[model samples]
Target: MNLLEEFKKNPGFVYRIGTDYYYIGKWICKPCTDEAVTDCHAMYEMCIQAKEPANAALYFQKLRAYSEFALDIPYNPAKILQYQTALVEALSDADIQSLTDQLRHFHDQAS
Candidate 1:
């Protein structure tokens, strides 16, 4: 069976972003141009509504990380810009830099 058919049969299957058959958990749909953008906005809203700044910061960081991992194409100008913007808005400079450094180190080691 094709990816869409497989995803339909098993809703829990994880689907990576930027693929044709991006799973929304319950079903698979064609790639949506604003999927990531919508996710970012939703997360941002949730963070804003959070009672604690710490919780807000945590979720914001998660959103930023997900965006980075989902958009792996460095050459894609739009993704690069979106990732940078999300990183900046979601984290303080020091924290974001620290996380970036740590991630880079981990990636280097894995390679």
Candidate 2:
């Protein structure tokens, strides 16, 4: 029997691809959930640990995308805040200061 047939017969089969695990029919496997979460957390951590602001921002963007897909929900304030916190943490001190300054300038200009 083919893999599809096997999956239909027993849909519990999970396959690992690279660092991520996928279910038989492109579904998120139960066993992979924890691993996926851990991987995402690690990615976020790496972004925080990055020396370069650009690299950290790139990783934060990727992390946001991944979190969105994984969460599969509408715009939830709590979730958005969580991701924002992570992204903020990923920024270097200099970058954070610059961003804060820019935000303040923009706010002052708008007001």
Candidate 3:
């Protein structure tokens, strides 16, 4: 069975092709797409499990930095752009295409 079929049979399955991550037939990336927001969240959880209060606080702060709901402050446009630049700079052309495909799929579903 292929990755897609594996995901369909088990929704919880996580597939990785090198640094590329796929879940439920969708491509996902870190620090900008589906990972950072939860990357921080997962780190925070780990801190909690490790009983490190200071580290937990730091991770929580990182989590909030990526999300508006965690705080009332609006995101800085420059910072957002910087993040976009970094993400795009780090990805190859094929990676960008994968991300674009994911975005199109999301928009199509929303429409």
**Model 1, span 1-111: residue lDDT tens:** 122232223322112222221212222222334566446535544555564555545544554454344433334444434443443455556654543443432233224
lDDT against the true structure, per candidate, is 0.38, 0.40, 0.42
Candidate 2: list runs displaced more than 4 Å: 1-73
- What pairs collide in candidate 1? none
- Tell me, what's the RMSD of every candidate? 14.8, 18.0, 13.0
lDDT of 1 at 35: 65
lDDT of 3 by residue, 39-103 (tens): 56556556766878778667655543443333223534355345434555666667666555544
Error of 2 at 31 (Å): 29
- Residue 53 Cα positional deviation in candidate 2, in Å, after optimal superposition: 28
Clashing pairs in model 3, backbone N/Cα/C closer than 3 A: none
| Predicted candidate 2, C-alpha RMSD | 18.0
- For candidate 3, the TM-score is 0.39
lDDT of 1: 0.38
| TM-score of candidate 2 versus the correct structure, residues matched by position | 0.33
lDDT of 3 at 10: 27
Better of 2 and 3 by TM-score: 3
